[model samples]
Target: MPVTELTTDAEALTMTLIADVDAPVERLWRAFTDPRQLERFWGPPGWPATFTEFDFTVGGRARYHMTSPKGELSRGAWEFVRIDEPQSFEVLDTFVEADGTVFEGFPAMRMAYSFEPTETGSRLRNVTYFASHEALEQAVEMGAVEGSQLAMGQLDAVLHDLREYAQGKGTRTELLDDQHVRITRLIDGPQELVWRAHTEPALLEKWMLGPDGWRMSACEVDAVAGGRYRYAWEPLDPAAGTAFGFDGEVVLIEPIRRMVTTEHMTDTDYPSTLNDLSLYEEDGATLVTLLVEYPDRETRDAVLATGMTDGMEASYARLEGVLVSLPG
Candidate 1:
């Protein structure tokens, strides 16, 4: 167990937990910031967490749910209040309903997390501030202390083998649920460049083309919240396959960090899929995680059957080449 201390003060209306881990401060920060690593230990044993949405910036909100052994779900959310990268952050943590609405009568808390370098590795201090003594007592009675300890106990293993998680994985896909799929690719570039490649028409036209013999015939991008984007592709020879394209409306944007959009086949009545794209950089490489939420399981399966991952891999490989050629 990494936890070194756990305390609750009724008069202070606060609960604090401290832990020391055998990982560098930067590594520890990544473990907390990356949703992939976070989900590995965010919940107690027998209750694993799945982050449906994670926006790691001030004023952004993260939504996740923990599943119990018997399939019951406990949903929660966090509105980021402050962030001082690699050092500390704070959030308004709240119990939420399935649709992300705050649960009525549930106690919400302000949680602050601070990370500092230690001689061996790093120390993490997490403090939860309650609204009142009654709220503090309620949290304690609800097993907050034990749950937190159990959750932190599992962090060491995650930090120990960080590289094995997603560093070299080309283009991997995870079926988060019947209606959701997560695809990840670690691009050999910075977050800003990758974001630009996705947003700039000139940059996007160069690499968004999936495979050889196909070119991006049209590339129109408006990458702001409520903006619309359109992309179309055609084969070099008209015999290979018919031309197709995708269009979407941006639902949310957080600059180079995150974007959420609704994607659908252009001119088709097919149901639209929600695509949540997040960028996280580590050791100068950016990880592109795209969470696609389909209207139903059938639709998700149908889309994946079209070799989506393979096509994405080809485009991503091209994207890396584009990034490398940039005058950095």
Candidate 2:
């Protein structure tokens, strides 16, 4: 119902469909990029598509098949031509056989998708260009317009489920004991990138800062065990004049797996704490668990009262963007 318009130009040999999705640009983009998400709404109503192979990069290929209620299989493939993050992408779409061969005499269309941000959500424009008027007419006769409309109509439900799943993965904090607290999150990226964000000084500065108007002034990391590390943050706004920092020593380092360290807040009265961070890969995502142990219950409670968990959650949210920007 949200599909705003569908148009065709026989002279230009193109078909265009525009839809406004009630989801952010990032969520809508993920629906097109993530293979699991793509499969859910790739075909028309009652004709669910199963993607056998999906690689969403420039020059990559995707192979899939849709099965109708009568048990007929419609195999299809796409060769990615260009991809521009959350903006647009172009691909060569073609009908194919089960053995990965293109269907003889079938028209191969060049498809382009553009996502634009609007006040309500994202506006998606899809255009398919045919080789000639004959090809365009052939596709139209095959119900391309109806099939595409049905597929795009299903995207709303997929986006809703993805949003709910993301909310469930938000930072979870638990009081393990009087002197220990554990914070865990299911991050979007892989373990390798998550580990790098934690151990690398440059990446660490991006999300380690506590709040707005604060900047990590200095960051140094010697990742090996027994190596020293220090980080300092200052208020960027001159009026909010305050500086605070922390220094630590790595007690253990396991690349892409775990790290243990001793940390002390330089400008606070709180006692030093031991931090144990563990990373695990689950279903292509990284789960990060951080345990902090203070010297005593009073110190732990004091730190908790400072709303540290809120800052951690905010910083972790920013880290998600950093992970998305990283090269694959």
Candidate 3:
């Protein structure tokens, strides 16, 4: 097991677990900050986590659920209290209802995670501060200790395979669940440029065009929260296909880091989908992750059947070419 030490202080009302990870501090920190990596090990073996919303900023909140083997879901939420980049961060963790209401019966805790370099690789220190002695006892009874050990034990594999997740990988898609899908691409540019390419109409028009012989005829975007964006595409030849477009209202925006929107076909009765886009920069390249939540499994399958991934890949490849010509 990676966990080298586990201790609880009744007087302090805290539980601390220290694990020695065979990865650098930077990699370890990214595993925690990135929801895709975090979900891979946040839950025990049988209970896998799926983060529906992850806004990684101070005062931002994350909502996730762990699914049991029997298909039962245990919901949870985390309000980020403090963040120090690749060093340490703290959060207020609480059990919540599926709709995100806090469950008062369960114990809420202040959890702090710290990372430091070790001779082999790095060391992770996780401390959970309970509200009271009774609360700590309650959590222990709920298998909190064993559960944490198992969760951290699964982290090694994730760290070892980090490069395959985002580096040099072309646009890739992962079916997170029946309704949610994750698409990731590593853009050969900095986060600022990548964010600009996504939000700026002029930049978007240049590369957002999908397959060959298509052009972005109309591109209007208001990147602020509550703003609306419309994009239309037309084939160079009329024989290709009919012109189509999409419109969406931005639900949330966090500058260059994250954006969430509700998207829909311009004149279709189909239910709208939620698109959560996040950008993270490491070295000189930025990793763009888009978490799309469709209405249902049928809708998701239908969308994939339309060769959506291929179109996305074409656009992303074009985006990289555009970024290369921009002034750094």
Candidate 4:
């Protein structure tokens, strides 16, 4: 029902599929970037796919195999050409062997995927172009149309489970641009609970430690526009003998929906940074996206090289446990 249209153009030697998904653009985009998520709905009905190799960057290659109910397997590969975040991307798709050998006898196709935000949710468009009319005809004869329809139809159910699983797992982080980085996670429980975990000092102290054996020894929060907050962490093993922290002011606040804050380190010479956090409710789960901006690309790269992303991931994993223990 979510698949609104599937059309083939003989003149252009292409097949286009349009689907209206119930999930947000970011969530749908994750289904494409995350190989494990893509494996779930990549094949038609009874034929499930397994990705043996996946590298989502531009010019990277992804190899996968689909297993039919009769135990037959179909192997393919995609050479990524362009990746435009949550909006669109293009790839060269071709049949391949398990060892990554291309099947030259089969026609290779170019595929483009676009995601557009709609009032209800998101509209996904996929177009596959062939080398010639004969190639297109061959694809159609090989059940490409039916297989695509069945595969796209599985997206709704896959998205439902993905959102549910993300509630406590699968937090992801990526570089958005030269000076911006984005981290996203689905928090279990409602938006208000996630908001408290982010803004309340006591809850923050429980999960915001940067590394193992480090504990937040002091935390103070004034959760309001123009309010100030401070957090200090010390090694749990007192013998480590080092303490570090950050203090900042809340620049903007929108209750449980959004917060913007400035952060200045107390233990380092790193330049101050701004963080914008936004929360959205999706089927009773809270999707949190944190965008961090730096003054310049050099500073951003320097901080990233310090393994901040790994620290954030560690902290987020702890946050999930804390969320699980909280009252829903």
Candidate 5:
């Protein structure tokens, strides 16, 4: 299991974002500041955006409505607390009814947004705050996990347009798109065959669609937590891209059921995080769920959306194809 360790905050707001837009912080700022621009591309697709009033300034309020394709309307307002032109802004946010009535169950939230110019592109962070731990927990349980993911999906699309609009190289890590692509395929094969395809390099090489030229340079396994293993893959083509893939620890592994491993691109066996992948045999097929909980949402999503899921799905589909070819 391979995963990039991103940020997981202690405060429990669970608010995360990854915006790799074409424009520098300035352009991203303008897009955020310009109410018209914000309205042009806000909410998920097929969702219409309408504003009652938007004043981008300290002490000012941004009242707006979002109408979903399914005819659902969720309005909200944000009262600005801090303002740093083209750089940062803080506001209190919440949802409300069409008649300007805030919901009772959901509490008002504080959000601090930051924009920075990155050598690769631009990074925008939203530090959202809730009233209490319980509130955050409730939000998480009430579809926040799925909601945040869908929001990022919209951000991905918006930034794609912004990159082109601003004539910048959008955040694209291979054909995968973004980091969080879900690998969903019902693989019908024997437990032994499925296990071999994952652990054996010779079998894996034929299945894995790593970056072009990626070959399992070295493969080792202990299959348990507190155990260690190292894997190195060489790029079949040196000139095409960077070569040298290494992760030297096996933090957790459960034979035939699950495996959790720490992966690092560097060879230092450096400080890193963990990735858990579980497999269950259901209806004579393997149901595999890979959850790479990163320390932060930024880098985590970078790998999630990248054809990682697509790549995995394709590989597993091929693996199943190969399995069918095997003699019964």
Candidate 6:
């Protein structure tokens, strides 16, 4: 029944972070407000973000440009709370969990960022608020303290360069330049055997889909461009879970050489993804690449946001099984 009044100097540790940065005021402002710039220092090192719908203004939203191990880019929104230009700004950040459930308890923390003019450069402070003491303590136990420290360190490095670079900049820069999901695998067997298991309907059903509740209801291909391939994936428990899965569009088909197809994605009347499969040969092993492109970053994020490095490693293990199951 009561509205929580906004506050400054929200603390995440014993001592709140002092807003002291080695850059000028304008550069510090850019770091927080610019999605691409924030991305450079947002996540820990080597974690680059691919932002979408990045409008960092009041009542606007922004998403972190992040990709899961399986080439899925997880995205979240930043509801702008306030913006005070070169001095302070606030946002309520939201993130996705692994199990595809959305939980927002104590999540609407007030982020108060400040940039003060320092004799040398600028002083910056980012104070984060938790709804309660218990929330803060729980976050601390979850390594939030250490993670914030690492992120601040990266922010320092990015701001240091931004001040100098801003003086000679041309136009707005985009972070997502020349980015694509890359898939690579090696399938052992003769070129034809490998090709057969990939294009031929019968062999594909042997080891492709997991046996949980999946079956190849229909598998047909024209084996030529201007031609197409169709696969019917009927879930055993349609009443219990999602419905049928079908999608395979022939983009390119060269017998004994290569086949490129866009996997038609359908999940309970919702559009899914487009997977491109390419097969080649090198060093006596057939090289197969499965590149999946999603309709939007969110869909990709749904599958990958969980940091699927281990699962992906295991999926490749299953792919190895798929190759072994092929007829030699």
Candidate number with the higher TM-score (1 or 3): 3
Global Cα lDDT for candidate 1: 0.86
Per-residue lDDT for 160-240 in model 2, tens only? 743343445678776755776767777888889999999898899888887777899999999987899999889989689
Error of 2 at 78 (Å): 0.5
Ranking by lDDT: 3, 1, 2, 4, 5, 6
Which is better, 2 or 4, measured by TM-score?
Answer: 4
lDDT tens digits, residue span 19-138, model 4 = 998889998899887887787679764456789888889999999998643346899999999999989999999998767898878878999999999998899999999999989989
Writing each residue's lDDT as its tens digit, candidate 3 over 7-112 gives: 8899999999999987899999999999988987798654668899999999999999986533468999999999998999999999999779999888779999
lDDT agreement with native, every candidate = 0.86, 0.82, 0.87, 0.82, 0.60, 0.57
What TM-score against the true fold does each predicted structure earn?
Answer: 0.60, 0.50, 0.61, 0.51, 0.46, 0.42
* Clash list (residue pairs), candidate 4: none
**Candidate 1: misplaced stretches above 4 Å?**
1-104, 108-164
Candidates 2 and 6 compared by lDDT, better number: 2
When summed lDDT is taken over every stretch of 10 residues in candidate 2, the lowest stretch is 160-169
What's the residue-level lDDT of 236 in candidate 6?
78
Error of 6 at 298 (Å): 40
Q: What are the RMSD figures for all models against the true structure?
A: 10.2, 17.8, 9.7, 17.5, 16.0, 17.1
| Minimal lDDT window, size 10, model 4 | 162-171
Q: Residue 60 in candidate 3 has what lDDT?
A: 98
For residues 135-243, write the lDDT of model 1, one tens digit per residue.
8888888889988987897686578643455667789887756887868888888889999988999999999999888999999888987899999999999999999
Highest TM-score: which candidate? 3
Over the stretch 245-281, how does candidate 6's per-residue lDDT look in tens digits? 5665666555775455665545445554555454545
Regions more than 4 Å wrong, model 3? 1-104, 108-165
